[model samples]
Target: MSFRIVDLAETGSTNDWIADHPEDGLWVRADRQTAGRGRRARAWTSDIGNLFTSTFAAPQPGEGAAPQLSFVAANALLDTVARWVPRERLSLKWPNDLMLDGMKVAGILLEGHARGVIIGVGVNLAHFPEGTERPATSLAAAGIAPPSAREACGTLAEAFAAHRRRWREDGFAATRADWLAAAAGIGKPIVARLGNADLTGTFEGLAEDGALLLRLPDGALRPIHAGEVFTLGDQA
Candidate 1:
């Protein structure tokens, strides 16, 4: 599908703009966001020179669950960032986060709208917030010249379109395979924080439907439908 880009000097949040205008194939980009947020409504620092963009795509039948789109976004993000930096330096964190040298440099937030789902992506192009819950880094911090927000957004749209088409045609199996190949800390000990409780397990892999497969101490695999996953030290 073709995308129409709307470049905004400033906005409350690119995702919010996309939410308001739920047009299929519409890309909303902002130089900076006043009220940017990540998963679970966590505030995202939208410093200028970073890339904050969101796109609206109508849901389709037989396209798998809405949550699986996170994988699609993650794959596209990996491709987008690889254009500048070495692909080996980038890895995908669970759900929808892009890591640079083991630090989070980008994130994807998927929200359901009236028309479909609004996917908001934030990339630390030239700047990254300090003292975040987890460590963060940017392309510039990695010693690579970062692309402009507009340039990055354009590349993102193209990559997103390609992955989305693959999703529509090839289904989640193909996307899941690629995601696992670039996944970080697989087979390592990790903790999945499910709000009030934390479950320790091994990062086995992903289920057929994209649920995180957490191997427990009892030799059973628990499919995590939703939670905050973090790789832990050798304590599991």
Candidate 2:
């Protein structure tokens, strides 16, 4: 794996850049992403102190990663954070966000094509920035203070690489177990927001393929393959 760090970048969309490069195990990171973005094309503010990165993976067919590469990326991050922060303090907030003490600290977004998968990650290292619609957080604010951006990236990248290698061996079942160990709301009452409709249930953890197991109010455990779920927050 090779890493290329640029001081600044025009766009936060790593999937776009990796698509053109397609270099095996290539990583692109920018301290400032002028048009940093998130899921649904929301504005992702990339300040000089934050960590914004995108990585490319040479594709493999019949692997658990084809349609659900995001889970793999999330698991890698969870593993990485667990090494630096206590498991109790670090939690995988469903699909992709890495939450610490109930505030979002990092996020992963994956885009794929016939050739490979592009994994984009944004981390708030310094200030979480005010004026966001959702509550946000940062590593420095969460007691992992004074850590350099380069140091955090190096640690996270190492963890991600190991986690990803294991994922290729064990598939999503193994990934599900690893993710559950670090998830925040497991076994707790959680609400799944599905835009117009919402499902209230207890977080029963994850299924074999990474779908959520929500024990609904009716006491029936439902398998939810799609929907944003979190504690107290309405899914959108």
Per-candidate Cα lDDT values, in order, are 0.92, 0.73
Give the winner by lDDT. Answer: 1
Show model 1 residue runs off by greater than 4 Å.
234-236
Instruction: Pull out the clashing pairs in model 2.
Output: none
TM-score per candidate, chains pooled: 0.97, 0.88
For all predictions, the C-alpha RMSD in Å is 1.7, 2.4
Tens-digit lDDT track of model 2 for 198-232: 88889898877777899987889898877677685
Best by TM-score: 1
Candidate 1 to native Cα RMSD, angstroms: 1.7
Q: Please give, for residues 46-85, the per-residue lDDT of candidate 1 as tens digits.
A: 9999999999888876587888889999999999999999
